[model samples]
Target: MLPEIITPIPGPRSRELAGKLRRHESQNVTYLAEDFPVFWQRAAGTNVWDADGNRYLDLTSAFGVSGLGHTNPQVRAALVAQSADLLHAMGDVHPTAVKTELCAQLSALTFERWGAGPGKVVLGNSGSDAIEAALKTSLLYTGNAGVIAFTGAYHGLGLGALSTVGIPFFREPFRTQLKEFATLLPYPFGPAGDMLRLRKELVATIQRRAIGCILVEPIQGRGGCVVPPAEFLPMLRTVCDEYGLLLVLDEIYTGFNRTGALFACEDSKVVPDIVCLGKALTGGFPLSACVGRADVMDAWPPSSGEALHTTTFLGNPLGCAMALAALAEHARPAVAAQVQASGQRLKSALEKMRSPHIWNVRGRGLMLGVELIKADGAPFTDLAIAIVTRALQDGLLLLADGPASNVLSITPPFSIDDEEIAFVAARLQEYLTALPGSIS
Candidate 1:
């Protein structure tokens, strides 16, 4: 229930395991640092115990995948039930009963509830898979190959998804392999006039390229949880409608009550033609869905005994069972309220710090960011990473993301208690206050 750091972080056992991993696994996969990358041995609720048995409060929710809480009882029970009856199945061909149920529930929760007809579902194993599915659907439905994405957006890293990924760091190495179908536009965060001008630029790009869809994240998660103005989504919706472009919302990070609302787009009252969902969809299981408007999704021709797009683990039964249980838990009214309250408490605590290094603390619900900057107004990337290191030593596990890696990403499970939130706030303030005058 609370953090208990028994030994120094990266304790003896973790160091040994990290050494083993460095020898056998790809070094590029996991950043192996002397004092970082603690291997998780167990996680429950808002806590994670490293291999060395050091317990720490999790603020990242394991990359926003455990919204309901790590190893939620209901989801675990569902996993157990599914494992006994069935485990894996032919996702695209001979589907399991739970998969069908999950697809229907996802449709009901999204498109159907949003005034669209029953939604069409394309299940996948990761967020990138879902994004690719949406991209493919857009291409087929609109008969256009090009897509419009935002600079600060992070859809995924798969080939199809990477084509539209906004981060140049991820795409640079694979540029030759990519199809060059994506055009990145500056994500808006300024004013009404800026958004209006963006609309004009969007129209110009649509006219110049074979643009079929516009892909974006409602609240840029990996992009420092940068939440645009209220007019941002509505402006995109207006332009998409006027130009016959499909609006594809990548809610992989902001979905499942992380944003107070079930989906961030709901607050804006803008219904995207297609939405990619993952991370917390199944608590801990690897499952994602690309749910689209019935009319838009139906653009794919019926299977002629063969599917156009699918994966070996497309709709694994275990994932479906857990997803069903997680969705049921999200249906409870307390989940949203808990998220909103917990977020406000954490945000308020951070704002009260008044540390000069603090630039901004903004986000909806549990998905919040604390931007760190130097007096010169440059992103404090080194200090942000240092803060993460210091926080870890103090029994708080967080991440610094965004282009400059200067924003502390604080997305905890909805079930986190006020005490844990207080612990995190106190630790953050301590770290910021201790910095030298030259930096602060």
Candidate 2:
């Protein structure tokens, strides 16, 4: 039971305030608009209400952060309980019970992959931090600084993570800092020639550069929810094995139940040397982790040696409790089954749509994308943006991504119901069919 919209998006008051905020704000990073930027008043379950009282279906899940739905009751309760006991504690110095509990649970979940070696967990405050941690772990383990990453792959925005990210636009400005340590590989998506060259180059790069690690996304999220070719990951694993390059899987977006598996590597049976997880890990709370083989993770020594990395809120107890609850909630067989079923229904509905602009629709489980195509079958970025804007006007929160940013990404909360899925599909169909310049 979602709430109803009572006014045009942003409303009069929201527009007025947005203007005032824009004056002092950077205005570049924040995507605020006078006509449409919905000011979120509150959220619960799969719906959110703007300041003007208009409710949204929450398709984007606040950038895929809310895994178990918005403001989950269990997580909220856990947060409150942990807060009452202790707000902040020295994580690396004096670990709390909740922090230890969370690490233990995560270890149990990853036991099949990490085994009982020195493989352990490193906590952080965000996805980029976790990614940076993984990057550091790789460097320390192999004692090499070089890294290989795929085109269109986004690891994080930090210096270390950015160095490994393959997107040029995001990193070009900081190229001086990233170029020396980074090597970009081709992302296997379209065209046979490009993919063939990419495969050959990847192996060559590993051998030539003496690469210490290869950072990859199980499924590229910001790169338009792009799913790689069936042979991509396994082949990369083979290359890593041959070169002794540590394989690091950035599951910040594809982890949790979003990909219908606890981890996306499960589909390909490709076990990475290091795994970086975030986004829904803490169920909307700010928590991230780098978990992997003990030898790789233990690159940093224990208290006997100085801590290489430390954060003011490293193993946040409140965040840990909420994460534990989130993990437990999604661990249920029933919840996992629901995500798989719903994702199939959503994908099927998209596949059935006939749009002259749609080039392709591909993804696994809840993380999916609809890529817009031109007449000659080239990727069309504008068309994707148009569809997203139209959907937003119709009360859906959507985004576009990829090298072109022409992918209409539909990664809603897994708790979204069947009716909501049908409604979203129907709305997009209507919008594209009626919109000006739409190919239909």
Off by over 4 Å in 1: 190-193, 436-440
Prediction-by-prediction clash tally: 0, 3
Best-fitting candidate, scored by lDDT? 1
Listed per candidate, the RMSD to the true structure in angstroms reads: 1.3, 2.0
Question: Cα miss at 58, model 2 (Å)?
Answer: 1.0
How do the residues 201-277 of candidate 2 rate in per-residue lDDT, one tens digit apiece?
A: 98788767768888999899998887877777888888888888898899999988888988888888888888888
Q: TM-score for each prediction?
A: 0.98, 0.95
Per-residue error for 384 in candidate 1, Å, reads 0.3
Q: What does candidate 2 score on TM?
A: 0.95
Q: What ranges in model 2 sit over 4 Å off?
A: 113-118, 190-197
Model 1, range 1-440, lDDT digits (tens) per residue?
Answer: 77898988889999999999999998789998989889899999999999989998999999999988888999999999889988889988998889999999999999888998899899999999999999999999999999999997899999989888887889999999999999999898633438777888898999999899999999999999998889999989999999899999999999989999899999999999999999999999889999999999999999998899988988999999999999998877788888888888888887887688888898999999999989899999988999898888877889998989999999998888888877788888888888454245
